[model samples]
Target: MKFEKESCSVKELVDDLYLAHQLLVPTHLRFSKEAEGDLFIYTDKKRLSQVITNFLTNACKFTNSGYIKLGFKHLRGTDEAAIFVEDSGIGLSEEEQEKVFSRFFKQDEFSQGAGLGLSICQGIVQNLGGRIALSSKLGKGSRFSVVLPVYKGG
Candidate 1:
């Protein structure tokens, strides 16, 4: 499938998140917003949502109990924003963190994913002049953060 990039407004993006939440309501989902600034970014709209969705999906799959939080914060002294999707689920190991974004890298031995989700997220973020990172502790949780440059007018 061909993927096309599009511009998205922060408010609209949150709306999309709500829609996705509605679809997954049966999964006992919870959302908490902690955005501090105007959450706007210049990137592929569809792919960006895909990134968040993938994170949430993975969280739900690994989490047996506890809450998932989608948080946002703008870094000071820069026109960059950080979006974090944190989950209180079974986290990854140090070695897995190093290769989480690598192509075809799956932590779960029984997982059937092609392992391109995070890889695609990395490429999309890089293409938009941004970076992606993650932090996790086994038996604790994982937090995936994407730092993207804000789109200013020409």
Candidate 2:
């Protein structure tokens, strides 16, 4: 996969999310938004989308009842925007959180994919001069937040 950075519009990014939302409906998926202001980021759109998609897919796999929420907010005094994907599913432990972003690390047997999603996300966010973090409580849920800088000239 090419790792070059690219400028992407908020509308375009949301469009991809909308498509994912469609696929999520049959699984009883739902999204709650509290996004204000324009959402934009300076990063590879494909890679970022992959991150969000992976998060959402994981949420669906773990959450059998409550909904998954995607939120967007801007950081003041900086060109950074925060995107959060939260789910009311089986959460991870503190130890698990420590290695969630490590390559090929999987929390348990319930997880799917090659276990490289979070690792890829960390690399992508770092490549864009950003950071990714997570918070969770076992049996409660988990939230993955990606902080990315907005493209100032695009």
Pairs of residues clashing in candidate 1: none
Model 2: per-residue lDDT, tens digit, 42-111? 6777777777777777877778778788776777897888777898888999889888898999877565
Candidate 1 Cα outliers beyond 4 Å, as residue runs: 1-7
For candidate 2, the per-residue lDDT at 124 reads 74
Q: What is the RMSD of candidate 1?
A: 2.4
Candidate 1, TM-score vs. the true structure? Answer: 0.84
Tell me the whole-model lDDT of each prediction, alpha carbons only.
0.75, 0.77
Per-candidate clashes, comma-separated: 0, 0
Error of 1 at 70 (Å): 1.6
Candidate 1, residue 81: Cα displacement in angstroms equals 0.9
TM, every model = 0.84, 0.84
Error of model 1, residue 98, in angstroms: 0.5
